[model samples]
Target: MAGKRRKVPHALHSELSEYSSLLRALSTNDTLDVAKRLTESKPRKRKKRTEEESDGAAENEGTAAPSKKRRKRTEDAPVDAESTQNEAAGSSQLPEEEPNGDKPKRVRKRDGWTRWPLLVTDLRVPEFGLDEEIEALVRHCLRNNNPHPTDEDGDSDPEDDAPAWLPHLTQSSSAFLSSLFALLAHHTPARPQVMQDRLNAIDWRMVLDILATCGSVDADVINTVKTRMEAIYGPYDGPAPTRLEARAVAKSRTDAALDEADDAMFVAVRPSKRLPKRVLEDVDSDALDD
Candidate 1:
């Protein structure tokens, strides 16, 4: 009669079979013992032995044999207690351990560590520390060289033909380069929208090659600079221009020619410009009314 009862629907039966298979796979055929299969076995708490029980055990052992080892263990019990107390006292001053009674959920997660240089708002020597290499690069950029220093031939140009100082200038350090780019971004004369437009027009590949010439700068470093530039100026997805074009656009918007003093203050080429004064009217309102 029980077997004659209406059978589970085909769909429900198939689902149940699939679920059973999954459970079997997960539990390794120990489905009924779900706790044992799914959860780790915790160490059972030790049962404390009462003094009477210990004495009874000792008596039973002594009756069996009064071995030297047994006598030694009995004699050392007080010393062991003292040592444990001392250890407890020493550890009392230390920080408490985190509770680990429950096992943490096992999770497969992607690595979140960033390879790019950290974002910085400024690169003042006083704060970030002055590096002679960075200083040389800054000077080279601000000096008699063209505002947008680029070779028309781009990377195809012979390395020897490149400025002797260009290769020698040290701007490859990711942190330093990132900070310098940040400084330039913060001091740009163009509005954010204009700056974004200019950045979009840059030839990033050419820029990478130029930066590479300085040293074996990591791709991550160049990426860091690009990321900061995009964040501040806005995303630039326009057609790629020559490296020179990109640099010229950037130079036109920024004032990097001014020298920075040891105090991190910039020394402007001209502190202030005198403007032509306009003549004021000498006539009074009273004479006009009359």
Candidate 2:
């Protein structure tokens, strides 16, 4: 049964080696493991001879021995005595065996690159944990943005101009973390969009994109995060803003919120005390109209 099991043949190994050479030029790291295993040109172990095969080989050896004329010619030629002795010793040497009679184990030698970065899993990080942890990380890293700046400022803004992550945004102090949570939210039961809008807002936020922005990730290490997420989610293309264009989106939302508030019993509504010059001009104009 062991004799019947074929070792990995050189022809296949050679073909895989060529294939790997081509694959090396390619950017994706996905097929590299299979390519490495396929090209492994491990030394083939000697097959244990069956009794029938051994008997046939013995018969062939007897028939295939050199003829008398060739033997006489070889004997007439002066052989180097040292070379003859070394060849005889090498031919006669027995295969190695342990003290207990076990054959030595084969240690696989492999290229250093082939060792692995080979983790691929379907496990989705929970949305709550990603949001909370990244939010915490942002809060922890921040020096000036604690206590949060509201629409109204206290004696000063908290040493930083903005408490928000992206210009004037919602939640999470790191734009990278916020984008991650937003990307994940689309897959969950909540099914909400990536909720953010600010100055010069462009909505394209892959994991690499955000990391690259903050100088955390190298620009050269191209994103493979989408390769995994897209595999699970089908197509990941879903789900941005500007201040003039943003004002259009905000005006509709603001009007809707006011309408909703108007229908409810009013608690209180007052003008904001710390309106900036731009807002104060708009407020003065509104007061004259009123």
Candidate 3:
């Protein structure tokens, strides 16, 4: 009975072979279906193979000899698109740093000249006594009507007829006058326009008095101050008296006095050659008595 069991093909043998083939075909089809499903998925899962597993697989496949284990490429790893774009936008919007490291500085403007205050100390007269002399001269010139008195014949005024109160400046006084004039000549246009403007804004009489008192020792100095004052006050050609014109008048009077003195000296030293015979006779008579 055991020998027959081994030799005789049972009716179930064909069915069993068919079942085995079908099972193999089904496994292959199932494997193919799994692969297709994986490809069609929206999000794909990457296969994670260990280094040893990959190397062993490659050896079994008869490919090139396995190399050293490679480090994963994290630098180029896939990132969320929205997150990456948000990061980039945030970095771009950051404010830049200033190279100077601080806020910018500001500049201020200067005030005009008229803003400066005057002090009482600046009003004191100089120690040279020039202020008194200049004041006297100015007063005399303004008050005295006849600086030079003419004879009835309209001839040159006699030496005695000259004004009594004419300004007779000393050598020191003359030097001061020259210096004042020089100062005026040099600084008339050089002084800042603002200073002139300030001067003009003040009362003319007060300004003139201040200048005259401050610069009395020298004519030149006085003139310089006057020139500055005039420039501010607009050319002072009006009936109002000016230092420049006063200086000129004073100079003329001085020259005339000098000329008269010279004439008197000449007359005293050199008697007239054409004197009358009677006058000569009287002189000879007196000489004989001496």
Candidate 1 on 1-290: residue-level lDDT in tens? 36767889999999987776554344322322434533645568666666677666666554555367557766877557787687669868877533332333455974322212222321112445335556555656654455555666445534335455653454445466676455443432233553442222113443554454333345466667667767654675532324435555665556443323333574456668889899987989999899
Highest-scoring model, TM-score? 3
Off by over 4 Å in 1: 1-79, 97-237, 241-290
The lDDT per prediction is 0.50, 0.48, 0.51
In the range 135-177, model 3's lDDT, one tens digit per residue, is 5565566447556544662474344344455445444566766
Error of 1 at 230 (Å): 17
Instruction: Name the regions of candidate 3 deviating beyond 4 angstroms.
Output: 1-83, 95-108, 114-253, 258-290
Question: What tens-digit string does per-residue lDDT give for candidate 2 at 1-290?
Answer: 36776677999989887676555424223322445544657778786656666666665554455356447757898778887788679757956332332334567983232211212321223456544555445545663544574555656554454354534232434566555445543322222244221111122234334444334433333235545545544554422112223445666899999999887756566777996565433357667788
Clash pairs for candidate 2: none
Predictions ranked by TM-score, top down?
3, 2, 1
Predicted structure 2: clash tally: 0
Q: Which candidate tops lDDT?
A: 3
Looking at model 2, residue 73 earns an lDDT score of 53
TM per model?
0.15, 0.18, 0.19
Pairs of residues clashing in candidate 1 = none
Q: How should the candidates be ordered by lDDT, best one leading?
A: 3, 1, 2
